[model samples]
Target: MKLIFGIGLFLSLSLLCYAQEIYKESMSLMGSDFEITVVSENEQAGAQYIQIAVDEIKRIEKLISSWDQSSQTSEINRNAGIKPIIVDRELYNLIERSIAISKITDGAFDITYASMDKLWKFDGSMTSLPTPEEVSQSVARVGYEKITLNEDEQSVFLKQPQMKIGFGAIGKGYAADKAKEKLMQLGVKGGIINASGDLTVWGSQPSGKAWQVAITNPMDKNHAFTKLPIMHGAVVTSGNYEKRITLEGKTFTHIIDPRTGYPSQGILSVTIFSEKGELADALATSVFVMGIETGIDRINQLPNVECIIVDDSGKIFTSKNIRINNNEN
Candidate 1:
């Protein structure tokens, strides 16, 4: 009887250990691929959780997508310089936060950048650069200060008629954050939401280890320069390796600096890790526009945020708090 009782206890422990399994689902949403992974005891539960995440992301896209004429974001852009449009609390808050990020980054990350004219093309068909006057005119209406928010009325107004706001940079990350939050609320133990490359994770893998993320090398797209062990939080990478144009023997990236109305130069890619995907996404773009020196300085001032910047010459610059493992250089 004693031997039988011991065997039963051991079998119970084994069953418990086998119950923890990780499941994943990937699909296209918000004009990008969204991958959701969750740990569960069975496949059904995992699928259900992933579905919930998918539904939540779709809901957010409907609310914030500028392409959707009925979306509040579209309404705000349409009425730019015309009238203040009342918006849902969620969108109002997002715009408010975007403005705050613009202030923090000293206009390096501006939602009003949407107002800039597309003077530069990166499709390899461009033979010459735009004239200096044309470049200057392109960003005439781009200014963060032009965005006005009314807290009492929950309205957003663009002071200039031609000014606009778009979330091409931060929307995916924000959706990732919201999806993660919703999953956590649904009692998910562990999961990852990867919106295009803006990834956010919570909890650990089924093996009880942290999630591992690889930072792709801008120069060599197939290889990763470093890998990071992330237990929680978010990671976002902004790079111009794939989209760029060369004119007069100078190569310009697709990422434009709104302040100067020109493509940002000297940085191939910038990756940022932060507590929220929204912050990480915006900062990655901001750093690319800010350049290495000012960008690294700004990141160093923020606690719990780290960055890795690869210059145009393949030089790597990291924030003071970051320690890279298996650095290629």
Candidate 2:
């Protein structure tokens, strides 16, 4: 199951100036809802800018989609353990970054987690936990180290035949980043590409102020705990509250720890603010699996990155840099 985040609902009023008009569009992409907003002089110009973003995101989805049999990603998976498959430089670099992140998080953020068998189901069908042996066997082929990349040839190889890689963790964020870059290149002064909950924004809103993003409360999705002004940056939230199951009086979330092949515990949600969407997305998932203390410590070591973690008990823990509006801590 994929992790869901409470969408940052931004409520902005339009300005009087026609040159600073804010045009918005919403559509479904990559199995999630994507909303694109552009601050432009006219509606037609905004539509063109949005079309560019949409096309760029579709192009990225085609390159990294694992379900599409003819995609480059699928071809790479098809040759797993048999031979190395050469791929585009963009994909190769993305995979390379994924491995680096896996190392940084100590294997907590592994793309090879796709190879994990579905031993634990979050759906209502699950009545009890799997046996210890069953749990171990499920992650037999799941390891970031098993993915071998040849930088010279730009090829990827899986050590095991059953090993596979999926970008469910970071693909949307990458798409958002790429789309934003494309818009900027097209001379878009201000816009937002919100790929599901992983969002990237540049420039200010039509009101001549930094974009206001409301961080929704995990306990209450309708209400926001705080609103932050983002001039230019990315924000990603990973939460387990939406998809979970309770068995034997114990609750299990949808986010499975790549190292343990088990659902994460204690953390209900993790929201990360960073300069890059891909980094924010991966770190959000890493924080969930790393637990509260270790995750907070890890995030603090990195510069220009902040995180807010909500535990099962509804207590909020933040990195040194984060400042909530209402709460002093």
How well is each residue in 1-329 modelled by candidate 2, as lDDT tens digits?
Answer: 12222222211222234347889899999999999999888889899999999999999999999999999999988998899999999999999999999988999999999888887886788877898898888788899999999988899999898888999999999999999999898878888888776679899876679988878789888887888999888999998899888888888889999999889999888999998898999999999999999999999998899998888878888999887755532
Question: Candidate 1 lDDT (Cα, whole model)?
Answer: 0.89
lDDT of 2 at 292: 94
For candidate 1, write residues 1-329 as lDDT tens digits.
99999999999987876687999988999899888999888999899989988988889999988899989889888988789999999999999999999998999999889888878888878888889999788788998898889999999999987788899889989999999999899888788998887789899987888999999998898999888899899999998888977778887889989899888888998999999999999999999888899999999999899999998878888999887764557
lDDT accuracy of residue 68 in candidate 1:
95
In candidate 1, what residue range of length 10 has the lowest lDDT sum? 320-329
Model 1 RMSD in Å is 2.4
Name model 2 segments beyond 4 Å from true. 1-18
Per-candidate total of colliding backbone pairs: 1, 0
Task: Score candidate 1 by TM-score against the native.
Answer: 0.94
Q: Can you give the lDDT of residue 196 in candidate 1?
A: 81
